[model samples]
Target: MALRLLLDSADPSAWAEWLPTGLFRGVTTNPTLLRRAAQPCNLEHLAELTARALELGAEELHLQAWGADLLGCGRALAQLAPGRIWVKLPITRAGAAAARALIAEGCPVTFTACYEPAQVLLAVALGADYIAPYLGRISDLGRDGHANLTRMQRIVESVRRVDPDGPGDRPDASPPLRLLVASLRSPNDLALLAAEGLDTFTISPDIATALFAVEPTLAAAAQFERDAEDT
Candidate 1:
């Protein structure tokens, strides 16, 4: 299956054309993106944006929580944009607790700002639906981002093997916990991770375009077309 691509666009206008590409499985928005778009940090606004994204064919919508109060934020998030929404919480103690509660209530939660394998493990333990690790940020800190992701992949596999009946033993175990690689700096990062069998990636529109521009991908498409024509 094609690796699921999520568009990380701040400005809705910036994604107007990209949305029609039909390459994205979801959209992710955060405070920084909202600030760039000059949007308010309110549930109403978030719900509206999420609805709009859904209308544009986003299967999942990610909205980040701002304040330090996880319970309050989770409660509010649980009520906003009910369908196909993943409330993004930071990797904190309060956030984990809130995520656990929300997951138990059947609300999807995306644990963000994960920097270590331990963080991902904690999110999984809390029954999070997704985990967003900042790959570019880790690289900026002079760490090997791919290595970290590989480590996370291994840890996830190990856990699944030990406890096949664990919280993440859903039907789609291939994309376990929806490993959403965020903080992408370039298109190559997306391709590299996708090739590495990472589950999902959230990338800026510019990076998305660059990734779609890869020569090998285009060649493969052309070959498929040629074969279809011949047949």
Candidate 2:
């Protein structure tokens, strides 16, 4: 599968602006991003935020269900649109139970806050649809983020071998469990991770912008266009 880029933002306006570019597949947001984006973090607004995501052409929506509302958020998301909203749950014991409950109720999950490859194994065991490891944060903790990141493919394959009923099983029937990485330092990190064969990324808007913006490359394109016009 091709690499899928998702914008990490809480503001619906950002989704409206960026999803139209055809590069972003969706938006991944939690209450923290909402606070940063200056939007109200309330339960009443959940449906509206989700609807806004879909109206703006986002094919997928990753919403965080934290602080005693994992099941509540799953129920709320189910009311919005089917199969598009993947609730973000931390990989705690509660989170694992909540994920299983939510999946039983038809809500998929993205297990977040992973820092190690072993954590990835546990998430797969819980039947998470996606696992998001914080690359920059892992590096901040002085861990070998690249080693963990590069090991994801091998880890995932190993998990699938042991559990055929797990996510990523029977590729013809279902899309594999995706490793949706986040908190990358820059566009350069995105490039390196992509080179490592990581297929999905949830990046900040600045990194997303930088990914397409190269002054030297744009200048060359401009010169080529000018010469063609003159010719």
Please give, for residues 1-231, the per-residue lDDT of candidate 2 as tens digits. 688989999977778778898889999998899999888776568778888888889898888886676777666766566788888888888888888888777677888998888888777666677899999999999888877888986788776788777666666534567789999888888888788888899988888778769999999999999999999
Give the clashing residue pairs of candidate 1, or none. Answer: none
For candidate 1, lDDT tens digit of each residue in 113-183?
Answer: 98998787887777777898899898888999988987887787788789877864667442357688899
Rate residue 21 of model 2 by lDDT: 89
Q: How many collisions between residues are there in candidate 2?
A: 0
Listed per model in order, the count of residue pairs whose N, CA or C atoms clash below 3 Å is 0, 0
